[model samples]
Every structure is written in structure tokens, then in C-alpha cells.
Target: RFNQFFSFFSRIDTLGLNNFIDPRGYVQIQQIMENMTINRLEIRVDSLYMDLQIQILGLCRKNNIRNVVITVNPGGMIDQFRNKLCTESEFGVTLDVCERIGNVEGAYFGQWRRFWNEMDVYLRKKGIKMQMNLCNDNGFDHDGYARCGVRSHIRCERMDRQNMGVIRPISLSRGFLPK
Candidate 1:
């Protein structure tokens, strides 16, 4: 049934998967990705294991998939893990930190602050570009505020962006003033 479900399809521009967790999540997601040939893949970073995320990236590389987009929900202690995504991978990186009206475990200002600031420090050295609220949320309703976070992804292939772009990421030291 599964093979037949995807057999006819040869390719897709993007494959988006959400709500990934340990119990039985990675296996199912792994199967789908292995089965389908996708141009770009989007994984919603709700509450997934860090290792599983790396495994998924490895699978994409093995398949020669081009892009892997990670839309991180605001409430995770992912600064350290995200550092791995940026420096260790042999690919360019982009980050978009979203600010919402309410606080949650994974999607709050502190995690956002930690991740973004760390990236900034790395950016000065690696010269990777970062953007904020760069993606449109596809009209999905969100908690507290209706913000569709920005889009940035890992690449299996090489890219040459040339220079830094977009406004600098938010900084608490300077004091945040939301418009």
C-alpha cells in the first residue's frame, strides 16, 4: 500500500512534515522521505530529537536531495544543536528568528536570543547570512500571534551567496523595540 501510494509520483518541489517526535515519529518520516524524491523538504521543528534531525539530513544527502528547510517553533533548547547544524554540516546556513506575543517552552525570546546571538558570533567568522521573519506563514493560524516564521534550509549541494545580506538579527543588549 505504501509503495503504491507513492509509486506513481516521480518528484515533488517540496515535502513538508510537522509534529515530529520520538515515540514513532522519526521512523515514519524516514520512510516517507526515503520513498519520495523531493526538491525541497520542510520539517517543522516542534519537539524532535536532535540526532533524528541529523539522521534526516544524512538521508537527504544520501539521496542527493537539494534543500532541507527547518521551521523551528519558538520553544526549544536548541541553541547548541543548531550550532551543529551551522558549523558541522558542509553546507551554507540561514536563520530566521520569530518573535511572538506569548511564551512557550520551545518558542520564546530566550531560546530565540540564545540561538540568534550565537549565530551572529559565528556569522562574523563564517560570514553566513541570517534573516528574520523572511518567510510568509502560508496563512496558518498560530498561537498568541499569527506570525508565520521565516524560512531557511540546509543544502546538500554547494552554493555561492557572495556576501552577508538582510538586517542584523535582534540583540537584547541593545534593548528590543518592536514596531
Candidate 2:
């Protein structure tokens, strides 16, 4: 079914699909990629497994897929694992750190702060860029507020430049901040 589905198109400018977790699926995707001309590919994952993420990233690099987006929705602690992300292409990848708005047992900020700090250091050394956001999961009708206890996926990277002020702790680095 996967092969047939992809066989319908010989080329595509953009493609969005779920994460391919199975190893066999990797081969299928490679085959499909060889037979297609995909300018941009987006993979969405709901798992917090860094190993899987690394594998997918490796596959992308192996296939020479330059333009790619990987959206990860970590349902648990991501700091528990120590995974090394290495890439040669600096400008082809973008990392978005999406967080839930509401607090969890009063340790949300502290816990996430540590994760982001470590991630910042690691990714900086690896020359990877990251974007952070506080998203509303329920709907966009709440004026972007968290509703006190609601948990929403924050995707501020999707916002326009004029509305960029809402993303907190904006970095003034050489290549990140807009001039």
C-alpha cells in the first residue's frame, strides 16, 4: 500500500507524512524517493524516541534530501535519552521546540528549562537552529492564552515576522535573529 500510494506521483514539490518507524519502511521510502523528485518533505512524529529521530535524519541525509521538516510531539520526557545529532548541511534543517502551555505539578518550567539549555548547547555545537513556541491545543479562539491548565502545542515558528514578539527569550545570535 505504501509503495502504491507513492507510485501515484512521479514527482512532488512538497510531501507531508507520518514518521516511518519500521526499518522495512525505510527501504520503501528510499525506493520511492529515488523514483520521485520531492523538493520538500515533512515528517511528523508523536514519539519522543531520539533514536528513531536520528534514524530518520540519517535516511534523509543518505538520500541527499536537503529540504526537510521533522515535527516531533514528545509525550514524555525527552531529556532521559542521550542522542547525538550530526549533520553536515547547516542551512537545510530547522528544529522547532514546541511546548505545552499549562504547568505540570509546578515543575514544568524548571524541567523544560534544563532540557532546552542542554539542547541549546548541544545543537549550537552541532550548528543546528531551533525555534521555540507555546501553542494552544484546543483552538485558536482564546487569544493565544493557555487557559490556565490547558495543554497545547506551541508552534510560534509558524507565525509571521510582525507577530514574532510573542516568542519568548529571542536569541540575538549572528545568524538567528532577523536584521
lDDT of 1: 0.44
Query: Which portions of model 1 miss their true places by more than 4 Å?
Result: 23-36, 77-79, 92-101, 104-115, 133-159, 162-179
Model 2 lDDT per residue over 91-122, tens place: 35323333333345433222554665575566
> What clash pairs does model 2 have?
134-154, 135-153, 135-154, 137-152
Give the TM-score of each candidate.
Answer: 0.56, 0.53
* 13-132: candidate 1 lDDT, tens digit per residue: 656565454535555555654656666555555543567656665656544555555545434324355455544334543322233333453324334446655655565456454433
Candidate 2 residue 81 Cα shift, in angstroms, is 7.5
Q: After superposition, which runs of candidate 2 have C-alpha atoms over 4 Å from their true positions?
A: 1-11, 35-37, 77-91, 97-111, 135-179
Taking all chains together, the TM-score of candidate 2 against the true structure is 0.53
Sliding window of 10 residues with minimal summed lDDT for model 2: 170-179
How much lDDT does each candidate structure score? 0.44, 0.43
RMSD of each: 9.0, 8.8
